[model samples]
Target chain A: MNINEIRNAARRNAGHVRRTPLLTSPFLDEIAGRQVYVKPECLQHTGSFKYRGAHNAISQLTTEQREFGVIAFSSGNHAQGIALAARQNQTPATIVMPSDAPQLKIDNTRALGAEVVLYDRESGDRDAIGAALAEERQLTLIKPFDNEAVIAGQGTIGLELANQAREEGIRNAQVLVPCGGGGLTAGVALALEHDAPDLTVHPVEPTGFDDVARSLHSDRIEANAQRTGSICDAIITPSPGQLTFPIMRRLCGAGIVVPDEDCLRAMAQAFTRLKLVIEPGGAIALAAALFHRHQIKGDAVIVVVSGGNVDAPVFTDALNRFA
Target chain B: MNINEIRNAARRNAGHVRRTPLLTSPFLDEIAGRQVYVKPECLQHTGSFKYRGAHNAISQLTTEQREFGVIAFSSGNHAQGIALAARQNQTPATIVMPSDAPQLKIDNTRALGAEVVLYDRESGDRDAIGAALAEERQLTLIKPFDNEAVIAGQGTIGLELANQAREEGIRNAQVLVPCGGGGLTAGVALALEHDAPDLTVHPVEPTGFDDVARSLHSDRIEANAQRTGSICDAIITPSPGQLTFPIMRRLCGAGIVVPDEDCLRAMAQAFTRLKLVIEPGGAIALAAALFHRHQIKGDAVIVVVSGGNVDAPVFTDALNRFA
Candidate 1:
């Protein structure tokens, strides 16, 4: 989809989704050696930007589809997002989540009135379980990052960034977005291309799960050998999406990769300097901006903190280890 | 100070300080049994709303006073606020802090270009130390919350709440503010009285250090029996300020007291649900709204999370214990 479709999606989700704050910190600027603006999507509804896509996709369902209900498969954040979105639209939802996923996320998703189906991360096939369940119940399957409506929904954040930048009189900026399947990156790139061409978008990923970065380097989709071991569990998809990769390849800049240690440091910095609690996956973009400052082309850099759904033990460990 | 003074302070601080977002959570709403909007001043410059008062007070200093420099005494957030504000105004700052204050706060204050003199909280008088330093150096003493300019500066947050409420079409609201010396509560109450008379503001304090609450109940200044033991170091003042107490008595609703355990829970909730890091003192207002919902008056409640400058270990303990 194009920017116009994203704008339409924005209109549809205007009051339904949160317009999270774009924050800045002098301490962060000092470390980066340049101006840095943080788009904290971690502060969005359900504590992640996934709510935007989930709300947009669920809200556009036909009456009959709503009656039949919807199904989604996710490790954590997307499940919570879709559960809350479906509940708001009065549509029943079933989420397939890894049994080993953070307990907080699973409890939260279930609390939002969604039926949860658990699967083993190493041995169970979540897609197969979801597909069979959807068929049995006549439920519509909502793919996390591959659907047009969902991409358009995530693109709305790009529109907000452009407007906020214009309001601040920033003529040019480099935006670093955490990437798993390239859906958020591609959507933002397209929106920025249409609304603020001067601002360039770059995808940021964990060092081991650098599928998006490798794909951009080779000019095609790529896959990661392993995904279950990364500290950044949220953005550890096995590969780039079929639809999202092409759009990202066309409109996005070269991608960046950050190690888990840098992500922990970024999370600690966000807590101390920005008074923000950012999960590991959500901090990859900020890590890239801080440690890879030399690669940035513009004076101003915007880092999108994508989600904050980490377990308590993980967050405490990050703070202690980094400190 | 009046609403016009607050408006002027807001204009003065327009570009200097961040206009922190007013966020909402459905989980929080469920707990409060009403719609709750959070004004997270924890995201403010220097990790607290003290920066507004410090900036306004320092900015209004006379040329001679600016040339000589400024002095203040505090254990944490206020010291950093004054240091940053004075540096921004090109004025040197000397801060008298407790010897046992958090190492993080002391380091942050010094990093901002302030000379820190540590006094033993149990054996030394910080006020005398500050007075002697001001006398020797001819430094202007910027009181943390007692001065008119400082109170007016803090009142700017009230103006923002009124405007934000109007934008959201909320005609009436109950505002909960974490109180130390009652400056924030008094200032906000006065501003709301003039701008949005329908909105009632209440002071929330830690149970052991409920000086403002006791003073409000007695209609006079009352001191806490102990001064230095509360976990909420940012707001452990012994008594309500002479100037701030009168204003709170005149305009504010009855004060609320929350236990330290409740504050810990609030901090964890903020981290998990709002993706915001809030200190123990900063979480008291939110704790009041969550645990003391029946005390709130209107259908819409606004909780002002006043600061976020706790040490790493303290924050980790809160998250772990609460989780």
Candidate 2:
């Protein structure tokens, strides 16, 4: 997608989405050895940046398409985002979720007035089930990240960051974004490329799920060997998206991978120092900024905290174990 | 302090202090039975609104006074605030803290380049020690909340809220502020009284320490029988400040008292829903908004989360126990 498409998406979701804050902490800055500004998308609706993409994609549907309703499949955050967005638009939504998804996410999706269909992650193909259901119901399928509209919606965060940096008189900045299927990273890179060319964007991923990092290095798509066991479940996609990898390969400077331990430490630090509840996946970029500070080149660094839909027990474990 | 002084303080603190975001959650709104907007001063420098007052007080010092340095006595947040503010102005700060203060607060204050003198809270008089140090060192004494400049600085939050609400097209709102010495409540009330007269401000206090509530009703200063206790140690002042009481009496509509359990619940809610790590004292106003919503009036309500400096163990307890 182009910068104009992203700008149009931003305008479309102006009042619908929250203008989340770009927060800073002296402690985090000291740890990172740079001025660190955190764009906490954990504070976004549905406790994730997925809301922006979901709202943007769903809001652009034709009258007839909207009347036919929408269906999507996700483990957590994306499901809640699409469910909430559909509910807001007075459209019926059917979300196909993994049976092992966090109970809170499932409950929240249902609470948002969506019909939830649960399938086994190991035994069932989520895509096949979702497609069959959508076909039967004549419902439009909303992809989590690969779609053009969704990418444009996620790019609004890049536009916001550029504007926020300008307001603070920061000309050049290094931005680290959490990469799953690479949609968010690619979208932000495209926006920054167009709006703030001086700013460099990098993708940060959990160690085992470093497909985007591998893809960027090899200049092609790459897949993870295993993904079912990572603590950062939210961004544990098996590989980078087809549509997203190209933009990221073309625009992003490099990729950074942080271990799970560092992600837990980052989550704890975010809670104690920044007073922000960041999930493990969301804290990957921050972890890279803090632990891999020597590798990043910038006076001002922006870390994107992507989501906070973690379970309570898991969060408690991270906080206590890391501490 | 009048609105003009507060306006000047806001101007002075424009770049020095963070313009913290006023966050909102639909779930919180559902709980509060109104549109609830949260002014999370926990995200402020030093993890509390105390930074605003301390910076305002210390920044206004003359060259001679600044060279002489400053002294203050606080159990927690204010100590860190003054320490950081003094260090920023190139002034040495001597903080007389109770020996029983949170270890994190003590470490943070010392890390910010301040001298810490710890005394027993139950036996030694903090005020006497602080006064003696200030006198002996020829240093100005920065009262935690009672000074005019400090009150003006805290009033900046009120100014910010009014401006933010206006930007959101909200004309009338109900503001709930946690009252310790009544400085924050009074300062915010004064600003709202001048800028948004239709907005009513109320003081929210822990159940046993509802001295401000009683004082307002009786038209006189009142004291909490028990001190050196309560999980909300950040705002466990024995009574309302002499300078702050009159303003609160004049402008604040009423007061709300919430139990400690409610505060813990609010803290957990803030963590889960708002992705905000709020201390028990900081969550008191939010508790009032959520649990005591029937007592408050207006279509829109503003809850000021005053601080987030709880010990890790304490926070974990709140999260696990409340959840």
Give residue B99's lDDT in candidate 1 (0 to 100). 89
Q: Write the per-residue lDDT of candidate 2 for residues A1-323, one digit (tens) a residue.
A: 78999999999899889888778878888999989999999989889999999999999999998898999888888898999899889899999988888887888889888999999877888889988999898999998888999899899999999888888777678899998898789889999998899889999988888999899999888999984777787788889898998899889988898888999899888887888888888999999999899879979898999998777777788778875
lDDT of 2 by residue, B1-323 (tens): 58899998988888888888778877888888989999999989889999998998888999999999999888889899999999899999999988888898898999889999999988998888887888899989988878898899899999988888887777678899988987788889889998889888989988899899999999999999988667888788889998999898888888888888999999989988888889889999999999998898888888899999877787788878876
Model 1 lDDT tens row, A1-323:
79888998899898888887788878899999988999998888888899888999999999999999999988788898899999999999999998888887899999899999999988998888998999999999998899888899899999999998998877778899999987788889889999999998999999889999899999877899985888887889989898899999888889898888899899999988998888889999999988888888777899999998888888888899986
Model 1 reaches what TM-score against the true structure? Answer: 0.97
Candidate 2 deviant stretches above 4 angstroms: none
Error of 2 at A92 (Å): 1.3
* Residue pairs whose backbone atoms clash in candidate 1: none
Candidate DockQ scores, in order = 0.82, 0.71
lDDT values, one for every candidate: 0.89, 0.88
Candidate 1 backbone overlaps, count:
0
- Candidate fnat values, all: 0.90, 0.62
Which predicted model would earn the best lDDT?
1
